[model samples]
Target: MGSGESTTRKVSFGVDDEDRVRILRGIKLSEDVLQRMRGVANIPPESSSSRQQTILKDELAKMAEREREAAREELVKTMSRERQQARKEAEKAKELAQQLQKKDSQLKALDAFYKEQLAQLEQRVRHSHMFHRPAETCLNVKNQSRNTAPVCPGLQAQILSCYKDNKDQTLNCSDLVKEYMQCINAAKKLFCLLINSEYDLNCISIAVSM
Candidate 1:
């Protein structure tokens, strides 16, 4: 009798546990259905019928579409902001490049001007060396090289060409003569300054005059 009673009690306990679980599951499903209805139209759920489910699905679909549209709008706004920022940075970089190019051009121009001045200075030095040679020294040089070759072959060639080209009237070659006289005068001035003043002072004086 006691064994039968114990077996009966165990069977009844298991059945009660199963029933409790089924009741909890039913309550959970009901809450889920209500929550879904409130999420779309905030309408209270009446029953778990197929019609009610269909209405909830339609509203949910509309809500999903609205969410998708809002997300798309947000995405577009984000992309536009990025594009604007990129454009601004590109403009900034372009302006910087232009500034650098302008600076480079200015530097090149100054370099060219400096090179021209240096060339002029070197020419003046060569002319001064030539002109500082006395007329007697030039004559001696000419006599010494007479049997060999021209002392200044290039200069002699130029003068000879000019004279030949204008043999009819010497006046046509007067320009060459004027250039030679100018060199001679410059040589005389440099020589006089060297003999009269200190070297550094003479250079400063020459720069001032120029």
Candidate 2:
């Protein structure tokens, strides 16, 4: 009576081919277990074997369906977790790429700024050097003037006196002017000779020290 009621309760089970196969396999496995149990225990003649077999098939099919459902739910959860993990990884990669791009842009900006500064400094230096040349030449002229020996005052005086005396007849001062020029030339030559001699003496003294 109990076996017949259980078969009636779970008779509607499989529809598709895979479900049918599972039902058939579950039935066979359950039948094997039943046969083993029957061997161990004495069979009661009142209980129908065919009715018991039908009840076992139905129960085993239901058990297989529940296990398949649980496996599908576990698979769905695993896929969902993998998808979430992949999304998080993608977001991290995108953020890292953006950071790298920002750093590269900053480096480029700094390079351009330094290059512009270097160019400006070079231009200022060029202008400074250009303006300094005339100042340096003026300084050199001042130094030369300071170092020069004075003219022959006696010769200059004679020329001036002659010119004043012959103011009404300027040609009479010509000889005196010529003599003054010769004296000035001779003095310049003597001064240059003395400077060269002194330079040579200094060189000789340095050589002796060495």
The residue pairs that clash in candidate 2, if any, are none
CA lDDT scores, all candidates in order = 0.53, 0.54
**Candidate 1: residue pairs that collide:** none
Backbone clashes (count) for model 1:
0
Which segments of model 1 are wrong by more than 4 Å? 1-49, 120-210
By lDDT, who's the top model here?
2
Candidate 2 lDDT, tens digit per residue, 116-196?
544553354344333222222223233232244345557556655765675444455556655655564464444434444
Candidate 2 lDDT (Cα, 0 to 1): 0.54
TM-score of each: 0.34, 0.33
Give the per-residue lDDT of model 1 (tens digit) for 52-95: 89999999999999999999999999999999999999999999
Candidate 2 stretches with Cα past 4 Å from truth are 1-48, 117-210
